[model samples]
Target: MSHDARVFLREFLRDPARVAAVAPSGRRLSQVLAGAVPRRGVALELGPGTGAVTDHIRHREPRRHLAVEVNPRLARLVARQWPDVEVVCADAAELGPVLDAWGAARVDAVVSSLPWALMPEAQQRTIMTAVQAALTDDGCFTTYAYVHALWMPPARRLPRLLRTAFTHVAVSPVVWANVPPAVVYRARAPRRDVRAD
Candidate 1:
């Protein structure tokens, strides 16, 4: 196994609920997710496991890059690997405050590797609410769902939740290269009035 995969496995073994996947995201999926970041603009990444997507995001060369990781070990690893990125070991649900504390009133893009399918509805709403609040008027938010779990309740509920949060939500075609396959959801024009309730 590659170094990243090994680390991902270890993290997943330690906290299956948080680390969700047994391996890091594939290059193709990472590229698709990172593509949402606007060049030279501020970018925020949630749950950058083993820096797979982070590697691609850095190539976009955003003026500022901030990553929020709930796992301390993974956060430290990502920080060490990507020195330029601002790594914060905290819950993604606190995205609003994290951005506020970082002095980034709004970010141009949000690339998330968070496992929304594994999250409870309330948790999903909480994080999505914070994401909407942290994005700029034209900012884009990109996240993905495994194809195999599309019929699952949490995954099925995601689109409805996203539609309520953002004015535009576009689903990508299946990325078969990824383990278990997945589809990206790119959302824009966050509805300012939407709140987690």
Candidate 2:
């Protein structure tokens, strides 16, 4: 694990109240996020943990990325890991300010590895709201949940909640090649005409 990932795991395992920030063990989710994202537009990432997803984002395209991490230590680590990436130390709920600071009026996509299942419903709603507002009309949001006990019904509530705010949403399984298998959720902003008005 990377330094930031180790720190995140230690903090998360020590206190459930603190947000969990484990890195994506494999690149499956990252691949999906890259594939779903646009080529030359800005991308936003929440709880990047240690640049695991950032690495993929860099490799896939030349577009700029803004990675928001609440953990200051992790933010510094990510800065070191990806010198070209803009690592900001801020909460996902306050994404608007971060995007503004980056001069990014609208994001092409939002990819995250935040532990949505562990957060309160209200916080979840807030983060989702911020993400939707920051993304363009046709932007996308992608995230993943562990495939173990973490993949229960309650865990699925995030994707369901996303549907209410987005016109297109999907969940795909990323089998056990990871330390634990995972499922990725991709959500797109509502378009005025999906079936053509």
Q: What are the RMSD figures for all models against the true structure?
A: 0.9, 4.0
Q: Candidate 2: list runs displaced more than 4 Å.
A: 1-8, 11-24, 150-154, 191-197
- Residue pairs with backbone atoms closer than 3 Å in model 2 (clashes): none
Tell me the whole-model lDDT of each prediction, alpha carbons only: 0.93, 0.73
Candidate 2 TM-score, true structure as reference: 0.84
- lDDT of candidate 1 over 54-139, digit per residue (tens): 99999999999999999999999999999999999999988878888999988999999999999999899999998888889999
Q: Show model 1 residue runs off by greater than 4 Å.
A: none
TM-score to native of every candidate shown: 0.98, 0.84
- Clash count, one per candidate: 0, 0
Please, what are the lDDT tens digits per residue for candidate 2 over residues 1-197? 56556776875676545454343446766676555567877788887775667777787574788899887877898898888788899988787777888888888888887778777777787787778777788888888787764655557678667777788888886656665677788888644332110
Using TM-score as the measure, the top candidate is 1
lDDT (Cα, 0-100) at 140 in candidate 1: 99
lDDT of 1 at 35: 97
